[model samples]
Target chain A: MSKKNYIRPLDIKHGRIDMGHGAGGRSAAQLTEELFLAAFDNPFLRQGDDGASFPIPVGARMVMATDGHVVSPLFFPGGDVGALSVHGTVNDVAMLGATPLYLSASFILEEGFALSELKRIVDSMAAAAREAGVPIITGDTKVVERGKGDGVFISTTGVGVVAEGVHISGRNARAGDVLLLSGTIGDHGVAVMSKRASLEFETTMESDTAALHTLVAAMLAAAPGGVRVLRDPTRGGLATTLNEIAGQSGVGMVLEEAAIPVAPQVEAACELLGLDPLYVANEGKLVAICSPESAAAVLAAMQAHPLGAQAVQIGVVTEDAHHFVQMNTSFGGRRVVDWLSGEQLPRIC
Target chain B: MSKKNYIRPLDIKHGRIDMGHGAGGRSAAQLTEELFLAAFDNPFLRQGDDGASFPIPVGARMVMATDGHVVSPLFFPGGDVGALSVHGTVNDVAMLGATPLYLSASFILEEGFALSELKRIVDSMAAAAREAGVPIITGDTKVVERGKGDGVFISTTGVGVVAEGVHISGRNARAGDVLLLSGTIGDHGVAVMSKRASLEFETTMESDTAALHTLVAAMLAAAPGGVRVLRDPTRGGLATTLNEIAGQSGVGMVLEEAAIPVAPQVEAACELLGLDPLYVANEGKLVAICSPESAAAVLAAMQAHPLGAQAVQIGVVTEDAHHFVQMNTSFGGRRVVDWLSGEQLPRIC
Candidate 1:
């Protein structure tokens, strides 16, 4: 047909979302066709159905995970909500030693949201997924009245495939397993806090929100059966993640505080904010628990990757009745690291 | 360790959710272990990993869909948020003629919500998934500060498997195809509106929230290739769904208004509210397009299923330049059935 035949192209440059854009009517279609479809253009999504259908790899196992992103500021220094949502779920699937395949995004947009901003976020998400070699095959959009929601909330669900005989789980950690850290911590949390609170610091802080599937794939290849568990310290940070693993495996963790890596700027920011780096979130880093025999191989593989060049062996697992995570401080004191008690910084990821 | 060593049990009967519950600390772990885990217990979830990994069906194609449910009142006469979230995603998967396999639920909870109510919603969601023979394999939870969100917003994503040869899509519709209605329309939308607005009539209305996978499987088995497209008439309701299919298929539709089924109570409720039943959402109903040669067999199968007992032939595909959805009124007049322009009812799910 002709250009005029279709609803006049959305005024994406300066248009504000209205109820009609989410009413599942003509306006919603225009928004989707003109924006989302144009950005996330893939064969599966073009089928025009409630869901997307694609053939799964014949013999590989399917892995699925979902995460809800409610970051305070939609945009941050290093990344925005779009890239964060993509990286967050992709890393979750990779934690299983699985190859990330497809993603489905569901957005809860508040009425009056600017179309231009939405386009920017969607474009960034599409780019992240593409760079990770995963396609956003399907998605859903809903708009809520203003004030009922923050600017936008994105929940990304990803599916991946794991080859046969690959077993990765928090419950697989054993007493002799050594824990490895991918890189410095607390950059993501501090970045978000700085942006949200408008705290100006001498040094610039950026979110470490990068996809880690490649780094994981390389590590898995290096020591496939030796790796016991893999986890990305996000909300409750390294301490909470270690605690979960210890409890799941019925073991204990002993960490050397001096061995753990934290950027100087991040450390100074945390010191100023009275925050604990171990408890601050890190979007790009990971913790790998593997047999002591293969710890060196895994660490070597991690050190070779750009995202994990700062990799180090931070701790070791031990048999303990209490499954506690204790840190031997640089000050010659040891303290038990426990789960977070209450909200520290809300909507960090 | 004894039970006393763990944090005190949550007060399910009278306690309210605080920042601690979502802080990813002791309280968060306790709440997850005592509440969400207790309700959604399964071998996969017990693994305690960032994501769940399961074996994929050998040769079946994977189908995935995600939906954001922000319905109001949390609870309605026929169903609550938990059940609605499950049914909505299940139906979306089934619309692809796939056998629903797994689901992932992500919740964005607002602080200060009641624990008892949250438990009720979780229980209902679990029951719905169990009834449909699908397990929720993985999930994520985040809490926003009070007043930052509605009571709760759920985003459910489902993954299903379709046999190799099965192909169903909105783009498959063709001229001379027959359209089928699974059951009565407007029940779900009206029921929610009634509860939200506190409007009561002589006869009560209830949401038609249900999982339609089994019914869809039966229809696909009986009419395989004959089936062109299967769509759930949700959000923008029947009219919007039909328009979407028409646009996708590059065809038009002619509907007999008298043949479309709407319960008397629902019709009355819509009339009282100055609403059009055609634009009212239905959770338990669907619209199917099939080859005219196989429409009879498909209709017969639908009529036999409990969920599709009220099935009827409501329209037919036609050739038109504009792909307009025009309906013949019961009074022998015809009018264009266009897409929904504005929000008829927001958060109607």
Candidate 2:
């Protein structure tokens, strides 16, 4: 196509990338304007400032969180690194009951990384941020030598506001508190690993990567003062995050293995790989510890959200001096759900 | 020496490394107890929560920033990736005029990354943090396969409290704003380049790697409301950062080329490498845009601080139709300074 012919809105499907896309020139501006801004249409980002500026809401405190994404093969079967990065950090800040407002991304690109791929990832990140009602206002870019790094790595930082009279922490888990899972377990991990291992599941399972800030708001509205702890299972996954809470709060937990929600495809993939679904990662899921008196209310709130349709109460806290987590197997026997001993899967997030 | 005898702390140096140090059982605890905790003695870190929580002062906002370091040849003449990682994020948060309080470091290590080298970087980072009065409170560790990643990459996240009544931003610059620079430029860029290229200079230069939040605090104390913007000249260097401020504030600036500071040795190294000091990066320097009314006061305040003893007034902003940042050369010529056409020396940060 002639240059003028290509000046229209980007043809997302038929377009390949060139160096000018990352050149910080007119092409870069066009990419941001046509693809990214279109995907992430938010008021704060519309201002287009080098960095965002805003005030914390009255009677509220601000929370900030950041996460880095360097997943290989930028585009994955389930979700790209861009969407994963947005969801990862947004969930991190939301776990504290904060309303996310703005995000900043820093991209480290390898010399040969395709600009088309970067634009796609950037657009995906922008889409996720917009859907979550958050904005990507500021960003930085740097390129490493071709052999020195992966294709691209993105680090995103987000700022959020937390209303007053709300306090949540990993150490707040108390005995008798209920453990809640936002959705099905191991979907994200299984999806990404399936692509990596060149194996096919019985069904095509997309990774459940999403921002949980809105759901967190709903949960807070339901159980304002009863939410104990909130954490998203990332690297070492469900088993590791829960163990951390158990160790931090000095309390054990009992989980019903069968009651925990895991998709059949994820189960099959785990079985094929000889991996435990319980120990696999979940991007869009969260573990909520709530007071027994408010557990039902919180669950109801979660169920009302589209992202939390499969939310379930899978366990309850227990009193244990050693803070050992135990789970009731489907065979009606109790087994120790200890901290992850060694690496299960790397970079599953 | 026997196997047990070889485990002596100081004697177990300059070796390929074994598993004892990162096991997180006994030897890991020993490294923490004997070296790190001793060097970085702080109440919050001593208590050792998953994260340190403190009382956020009333009427103050908190700022948080995180950065990941994946530089090659981990060690160089003047500093290593360890010190740069800590100082980099702290400076980012401090550029907002916040008082840095705590830092969290997440380490991604290759399975065979030398334990001794790992210990050295940690110690350097710990010492740098302690010296700057910031505590290393919480951290995470992961090991990736050697071929999958570099030797080590350190991701540091920092949290700080912004004092009340202090609002600093790149957009805060206005017409008649004077630009003041602290210390010599290009030292860091030249130092890293020299070591990387094995180049020689009349005088060996050192990387200007130091925490600048204290200087920021001092500048605020001197002219709190007068300081409009503070920026560190990092990856894109001064020329690009100044252009950013100009674009953000919709003002133009004229830099006096001779008034800007550059060490002779650094200038020579840049010349040897075909790099310009104006576009070269700096770690320990900052760009301050303030009202002309308080320029002297801010300059005086910076000069009093050890970190800013060489601070100088470099330029003044003006109302320009083009909103261009130009430099008046020592030889009496003028030219427009633009945002880096591309990153100047990628990954120099």
Candidate 3:
């Protein structure tokens, strides 16, 4: 053991967690500050209310989304289950073209969870929720016996309000609409997998786990009527989302490989692992299927937003009973963008 | 093995579940009919929509609630996990004075989860949701590798609309409010524990998992402004719920043990297990704290419902900054109803 351990100020940073952190005691408060408040520092969350209350804007509809995170490892390279949980649900609610607002978190920790690590993850989640302007309010904490549960599982429910005249959905795309892609994909899937697989890459690439609600709001303001559909390509990546839209709307799609974007590192990693980047997951990117007339406006709006800086027009909607998703090749060939049989990188369903 | 195994359609009285029941084919349908539907027969459930659709009444707001069932050993006396899951969430949403409208279900099944068992559960949930005048719509299913997951976990989310001007909460209890309970307590907990402990009761006991929304709606209609607080004593039982309410509303509670109701069988079981029936869980019960003037009206409303036939006035709110929950015993004794220190029984939470 390090000799300095006996002399330090209890080493909140280096120490493992105990029951006191979840005990609603002094340690719990410190954990909240050092870990949660540090990662998420905003006015509403800073208020620390039993429940958050805000003014309801006129002609706006609210969207609420909740998610539970029960990842195995407490700490991951780019993120932990805590922050990912906040971002995952924020994005889900954001995908509806709403201005994401308050968030509620419920944590079920297995007894003996390291307080230090729990604090770290909580801090990260709080930070993300804070920066995204979403406050965590009305949270619940419970502990299960060591053998009865995994380390911890976090469930977050997000609420937001959508402006009027904004209609976006998986089934909104028509036969003549154009589909746009927001930058390179598969970074998130590869990043999480690399950590899980203990693999190393030539260059470190962090998972794209940022909030995209702000970007969505900006696009809605730019071309309110032009947008047809907005969807985050997360679980099954672009292929699955597009396929879902196609099946829901009873339409087909055509994509251009030359226009499609992929990070070189991500592509190489997929090849090495026998995975398809198209089928790989993405947490930060989105697909906007819109009418051709408003394509330029939506593209311009997307590029203006930091998260959508690399946005590009990559496809168009088509009429087909089979609802096949086809993509053009970089080599001037074409192939079907089929449904993923299983998740490219298995984490949780 | 019985030679009758090869014989066609040979069976015992009610029949027992076997491996083939969970295989998702013919036996599944039979199991659904014999077990789930037979117990939960109703009209709306027979339609079997992806989600239930119904019209919302005017002058009322909608409420939605969802709960997940990952309970092991699907079948239990009085109710299995399937029926319990449906009743559990429905009651949560219903306790808020809103009429549950529709429910959405998502199932995560470990590979090889028997089809018959799955069907039985689904049908049971459908029946409960239907009986409660709520529909099951828009469902999802995912299969995980055998070792990666448990047998099955069903998540059900319900939506309901609340009536205007009805403000009910744990924090709404006032200094002079009276507390009332719907019926005898702890039957559900004892029923479940009996099976878990493999103990045969001197008199058979069944769980009290039932819909309380109808009772709640009736209460609201009976005395809209009279009811201040409403809570279903589920996990930590009546004592825990009252304590929470007392803490939240910043008021103390004084209960008369003679006024509280408990089935003799439940009381006997609690004595055998060395557990407090007041702290044991109750699925089909509620604690209502209301103004003294409206107590009779609220009691009358609760009594009109089948779930609240044994409604009783138990206590009253008192002025105390410490928010102590004290009980005056039937034997002219008194004791504090403290917060649950450890689990009454793990996993009941």
- DockQ for each of the predicted structures, in order? 0.69, 0.17, 0.10
| Predicted structure 2: lDDT | 0.73
iRMSD (Å), candidate 2: 6.8
- Candidate 2: misplaced stretches above 4 Å? A1-51, A57-62, A161-165, B1-68, B101-111, B136-144, B155-167
Q: For candidate 3, lDDT tens digit of each residue in A195-302?
A: 778889888877887788888887888888788788777766788678767866779999998888998988888888787888777778889988888899999999
- The global C-alpha lDDT for each of the candidates, from Candidate 1 onward, is 0.90, 0.73, 0.67
Quote each prediction's TM-score.
Answer: 0.98, 0.85, 0.82
Interface RMSD of each: 2.2, 6.8, 10.5
Q: What is the TM-score of chain B alone in each candidate?
A: 0.98, 0.89, 0.83
Name the better of 1 and 3 by lDDT: 1
Candidate 1: tens digits of C-alpha lDDT, residues A1-349? 1211454688989998887777787777877888998999999888878999887774467789999999889999999999999999999999988888899999988888998998999999999989999999999888888887888899999999887767888889999899999999999999999998899998899999999999998998898788889999998899989998888889999999999999999999899888999999999999999999999999999999999999999999999888999999999999999877687877898
lDDT for each residue of candidate 2 in A1-349, tens digit (9 for 90 to 100):
0111134676566664433444443344455567656666665445443333344345466555656665545676778999998898788778866777667666656666665676778878877877787777655454456555567667776666667778787778999999999888888878888888878666798888888988888999998998988888765567767877887688899999988998888888898899888778788999899999999999999999988888999999999887777899999999988555445666665
Cα lDDT for residue B247, candidate 1: 84
The best-first sequence of candidates by TM-score reads 1, 2, 3
Off by over 4 Å in 1: A1-6, B1-4
